[model samples]
Target: MTDRHELILTCPKGLEGLLLEEARQLGLEDAREQTAAIRGFGALEVAYRLCLWSRLANRVLLVISRFPTTTAETLYEGVRSVDWAEHLEPGGSLAVEFSGRGSGIDNTHFGALKVKDGIVDRLRTASGERPTVDKLNPDLRVHLRLDKGEAVLSLDLSGHSLHQRGYRLQQGAAPLKENLAAAVLIRAGWPRIAAEGGALTDPMCGVGTFLIEGAMIAADIAPNLKRERWGFSAWLGHVPALWHRLHDEAEARAAAGLARPPLWIRGYEADPRLIQPGRNNIERAGLGSWIRIYQGDVATFEPRPDQNQKGLVICNPPYGERLGDEASLLYLYQNLGERLRQACLGWEAGIFTAAPDLGKRMGIRSHKQYAFWNGALPCKLLLIKVELDQFVTDNRTAPPQPNAAPAPVEVARLSEGGQMFANRLQKNLRLLGKWARREGIECYRLYDADMPEYAVAVDLYRDWVHVQEYAPPRSIDPDKAQARLLDALAAIPQALGVPRKKVVVKRRERQSGTRQYERQAAQGQFLEVIEGGVKLLVNLTDYLDTGLFLDHRPLRLRIQREAAGKRFLNLFCYTATATVHAAKGGARSTTSVDLSRTYLDWARRNLSLNGFSDRQRLEQADVMEWLAADRGEYDLIFIDPPTFSNSKRMEGVFDVQRDHAALLDLAMARLAAGGTLYFSNNFRKFELDLSIAERYAVEEISAATLDEDFRRNPKIHRAWRLQAR
Candidate 1:
């Protein structure tokens, strides 16, 4: 064997540069960057050190031989020329990995077969015995790289991909690979932060990847120190004593580093289940005492005041790809900005996300942005300074426009239009407040675009308020509209005597497809309110619509009055509000169907909150499919679908205006004879198909469905009563 051999260190696609730097630091000479890999020449000790110490590298390959080849026979002969007995013992188990293709080796599987055959034939000829293959846990792992007519066979010194640190036994929905997580921490400057005694916090840490990796870096522990076995362990060329010495040095360094006051590395997760796995990973990594994982949400997480205040806050918040709706993510990003500003001021934050648009919504401008790949999806790591100035918005307020005549009565200090908007809101609250109390309503809409200029809807849930702004027309000047919105938002708190923070504002616009079903925020703030004697959970900040639909109060009441001793069914049951009402009204049994797991979970919580769990089944399935398959009959059924939905789980896009006829027919099939089916939709332009009215007895009861709160917007939703003739 040569004293100094050529080595190749492979890493993730975008981390080649960092790996090159790491190689240079490991005393490898002439290190150069390649596409997704780094190449250099090093002694055997250097190679062994890299295998044990390099955190960013995926695999360390020591070049055995490279030769030109034009056919599979030549490839086989070239591999045969190498002394296989020097690498693999006779009768040992081995695995071969091949990539690329030469002239005759058109596929990787065949190429690997040729290479394996060459090794086996050579070993059999020399020692009268050949090594068996073991892909799962091999004693020898060989890699062959073919390019054009050239072949390079190298021994894989790292047995498995170094990313499999064996620390994480479980992961969350989307987990960052261990090596990738280490690369992120190195790039995020976690090492430097730790050296300075700065704390590390991950508010949205999933399975504690960042926290575990950060602890390893701070404690100067070898990433693979705890690994049981390596590729070199079973190889003939492995020097056991030298490797043992290096391992002992790493163990001693880790012990000394951890003996000091442990770095303040903490992680918070909203999911309690995730927190346990994170703690388990930390413990498995041998840093459980150094890093702490807790159960908490981003909105409620606060940096421990007793610890260091100048630490880094690193998180990879959801980018709305597999989880959450994009529109609702805006609220989440904005709330993250608020949390950083309020709780983590003067700290640096590194946010890794796939959506730059959502990152911009955080309101903090990045000081430096690094490009990365979270698997195939292109992502960015934004480094922002969480200072007070980043939270301040520069919306210059316009002065009040002078009216032709001054009012004789003393007025509050507000702009002219603001005063008028305030007055209009106050008047509506008085009007709706009276009706709400008399009817036992704890939540109701006070205003719905009453003043066209405001173009906002305000609803009250106990003392908390939810305001939704309607996106204005393109013809309106954006600056003017923003000024008016600020004025209205300011006037809301003063007019209603509610704290500014208690009011959550979300922009209401015409949503397309499943965008309406997306999450708006993850505040997890739910308020309980009574409507017609039934208690329900209502979340005003996390979703586009609150859990309970205020406009549906009249319909729910109607269901209660007519649902005695009847089997009830609710299709597209959001939060199962109608089901809860029916169950309370003495319905024999109820089944609610919806497509969203989040909403179904909310529905279960609402049912459990009301002490009505049994006899009421919540089915999380596509309503359209459920209707077609359901053989059970119901005395009364409620069908309320979104205006349009293109959820990927469904068979096809659902357009209420176009699919109402077929939907009603499906619902009608399950309705018993003389049973009633209440069909409703919020599509303003929806027209019931004429063919449906001809087949069944249909009555348009839209007028009677409107309550006092939705009286002004009579078209808030249209309803009908259907029964078989």
Candidate 2:
């Protein structure tokens, strides 16, 4: 009856996939992910339900006009062309919001003013009366965006950023935005994980973001149920009847999906800085009974595996970018890897860190690495693929699907290059470890010679020996490998000469690479922030990702120290660890978004096995579409897109290496200005499109976002801090 209404739910760039999935979950089946927004046809009720439930969006923009216009005069004509009476009451107060990039009228404010002028002039000319302009609060809000010389006029359906989610009373530094947090969980693979008996865990759980998000995902709870109003509700076309129906259906679905197992989402952090905030946020999200929070250390973090399968080990460790010393972070990572390997045997583990060195410490090859923007800092999500006996793989060679954030890490081993160097390095590594062991030094070699290209990396912990990173010749080359192994066995006593029984050698193979952060960095030109919550050493270099992805790092830090009353999204997320960091920060719910199924599997292991959030989860799909169809807004969002990718499903042959302009434009469109978009890109040539919509300001924060090891390629990722104006 009411011309099938169309609305747009804009989300951070690269989060479209999770957003689309959110829409589908909320019964918005027809929902679809766009380049930077989600489009759907629904009644006002559907809009309201979306405002109340979506876990991965920044704002819901209701398109009022889609027209081709090249000049300000053309903009006026178009605005006048629309039936102003249908939206604004004759004398009703109205406000204008504008966004544009590479358009004839680049000034967002000027464009908004022009649109406002058009609406008032038309109303006055027609009825001898016009609506008054109200900047702060208005009965009607008109939103306009100029893109590539084109304009899309829309109504601000959700006046405030959906990230406000009507919760979050208390917060700490750089708390995760609700939508971003939810996106993170989705990227980590939440829906499927919560559907199964798997568990979710956030080791550095801060304010309870990951915890609440986990509960919501497990219970299928709408992320925005507590919100009271949406911009669309105040519009003249607001339909109470349809809105009520959508609300009713959403409620029914939520009620029906309320029960799930190992849904025991928990946030654990020793820092007192996050406890109160975490508690407050949990209550704000109305997840008191379902999720739990604790104050403790990750070192002592020992969680029991579920009877069915081991839980996921999700964590956002300190990259030392905003915290500690980067030169030695490898040692901290070494400890983290050792603990996971020794204590978490049956489970898989997933970690989210801007610093790849920290992930390497976990001693597992990453199967998936996503590029995400934590504000404007280009970063990666390294999904450590842990092999476990439980769980079977799903889907293979599927049709083209969706979009989301940026992530580029090693996808497969580079078998062609550096073979000779690898062999030499491997031989040297084994010899060193064996010499150390035999010499009886109270040390443990963490890596050894196994694969040929990796070239032998070893760690010496307190009492154990781990060896990996060595390249073996091949199946036909067992002799060389065996000779190296035996030589090293003899060398252990030669290096330190303890005893064969005291030495433990582990072989590791290099996997595919989506990114390579092997450059050397400069000295203390960067700052490193390490709270015990982050669990990392102070020195180290040559990490895959920087320590902090300005976009999501704050959320992870907040989870380690603050996530109080919000949901979190980690779009194009690699591991749910950042969500775990949010959980530690006290978030109520978390959704991890990503396209790699292998990473999702690791996400479950990281969460459940490590005793993080058991409810919040992993989602595998293209992030672009996910953001496009999502119905909810989050308090926090972690936007990280990849540098370059070509999959059968997602369109626009993406290459952060090239399309960063459109990429950032899409992400900012969905960000809650007062909210954040920690935009990050590793394209050494990465530069902010200062010309893009001026609605938000970009702050070059590469220095603050960098860790010591990544200094070699200071340009590896350039981070920008963004806030809606």
Candidate 3:
């Protein structure tokens, strides 16, 4: 019944040491590795040549019986002593599949219904007809396993999972399976860069699993050579002249690896709906003239290829498993490490991630990494070689040198409390950089904790420099408040001329519930600042508040000078930057509200970046159930909220000094008569519930909404207004 069988194989769990070195280079015998299989023995034509050449396998099996069960009646007496009328017939159909649990044969669907009732009671006691169970095309699939308590069973010879090689029938929202993209192109060596003729790419390619697994490892094709149907195609120990001599030697080594000369494989894909389904999965893996698929965009991924070729730039990117998707997948892995250091410089990248801290912000470095897993997540890959000394120029994004001057304040390498925090950050950058370039303000708040032993606040945004700190005070000394926060993050990129990766830092503490709207770094690095003249969208390294609020710039320039055709309303609209300054002061309709679907998707990308998303709106509920189911009124309201929130998407526990009188009586019942409202919060022991100044006339505009960069923290927030009288 065998010519030396045993096998096993499996895979995808960090590719069991690259599927035990490609099953001992296909001959298999005594192979080894285990967790995520490999085991091995051979013949039966090396498990039909690892089910037609294993590209990091996923099921090959074969074994047929191993026994020693501990329950389900000794696993139905080891599947009725494995005969099953010589591999399934008596009206053939079969399926099984069982996998691990414990000796008690813990449920894998009742250990696949007791091994399909011991292979239909041993083929209905000598062929009285019984088979029938085909869990989708199964003239006998079988498997079993059990482990530790031992059982094994086997047989599913390469069926539904040879990573399906059925040319991804349209994929994308996280795909990568084709044998984990052929074990990330055989650990990014891409078969010695396609045997030295070198040329591959990917640049975030999605439906093109690493350009059809690097064009079937550069043409030596046969990753399940157009897989038709297997799991031992209709068992009975299938042989058909030894599988037509290994399927006609893998279709003549895939037609002499596609008649040689084509290898410059490409891919691109910024989802123009995954570029015609990745060129229809490279024209169904006949590799449409050696991989191509375009629709570009990793910040202009350019790989014209054939200029003395340099191959291998692979990708997998988007490791952002939800939660604000790493703030734009940290600039899509820094625009794929700046298109591999400006267009594949000495090419050889790889990447593949599950957030190895967003692939170390892809400033590029990985001189080899590996790991792998993808199915139960795990991941990694990395590799890199696009050298310029592995490029990490403080996580890239450099470019600005026109007049190039500001790198001076190395204040003789600080440490006298970092030269008094670099002379109070060069005296608040020469007095808030001349009142933020004479009020054109590109985002301000220069220094806030002003020297309370570098408590920190910093701010800037334009030339980026966020900072924050202020956590200390547990009677200080946690290694002296982490050496005064490493002397104010080494004097904030040299007193702010910037570039310590344009400084970002965090800490601030004392937050609760919606913990200052969570995510402190997925790096989706937003930027674009401006202010009273509209532009907003700040991210500053994914949240702790950067979606603009430089002390609400004089109350969003007094809601863009009393929003013109007034209808505004903003309420806790954290990223609505005062509803884009009340829709750039025109506001005939705005809305905003927010229970934080990550700040209402950063207030719908700051109202679709300024064109004010056609009359704005946003509303991700619970701003007190959308202002008591808003009866639609608003003539400019603002609100702010959050001196404490409970945000399990709310329904209890908001305490801006105990729900500032039912949140200013639900914004004065959506105020329409004499409209007005405003009412801010930042707590600082808030109070204003003076029956809202006797049913609304109030005023205190918190010292005229303190601006010039938060006039020395005027409690940082507190406004008023009201009206409806």
Among these predicted structures, which one has the highest TM-score? 1
Model 2, range 615-707, lDDT digits (tens) per residue?
A: 486777777666666665565676666666665556656666466666555555555435566666655565566565475666766677543
lDDT of 3 by residue, 1-725 (tens): 96898888888777898889888988997789988888879879888888888888888888878878788888887888778788877788878888789978667999999889888987884537788897988887888878788888888888788888887888878787888888888888989989888888787787888888878887888888778788788888788898888889889988998998897887777768778887886787778888777787787889856556898888787764433332355546655776678778888888888767657656667987988878888888889898788775432222232246543221213356866876777776777778777888877778888778778787777777777776777887777765566556644655555555567666668887876678766758677777667787777767777766677688788888888999888887877788888788888888887876877887787778777678787877788877777788888788877787787757778788877888788778878887888877776877776677887788887888787767887888778887877
Quick one: ranking by TM-score, best first? Answer: 1, 2, 3
lDDT of each: 0.84, 0.59, 0.77
- What 10-residue stretch in candidate 1 is worst by lDDT? 401-410
Report the C-alpha lDDT of model 1 over 24-98, residue by residue, as the tens digit.
Answer: 998789999988889999999899889989999999999899999999899999999999888888888889999
Alpha-carbon deviation at 121 in model 3, angstroms: 4.5
Q: Lowest-scoring 10 consecutive residues by lDDT in candidate 2?
A: 393-402
Deviation in Å, model 1, residue 46 alpha carbon: 1.0
Q: Which ranking of candidates, highest lDDT first?
A: 1, 3, 2
In model 1, the Cα lDDT at residue 473 comes to 99
Candidate 3 is scored at a TM of 0.37
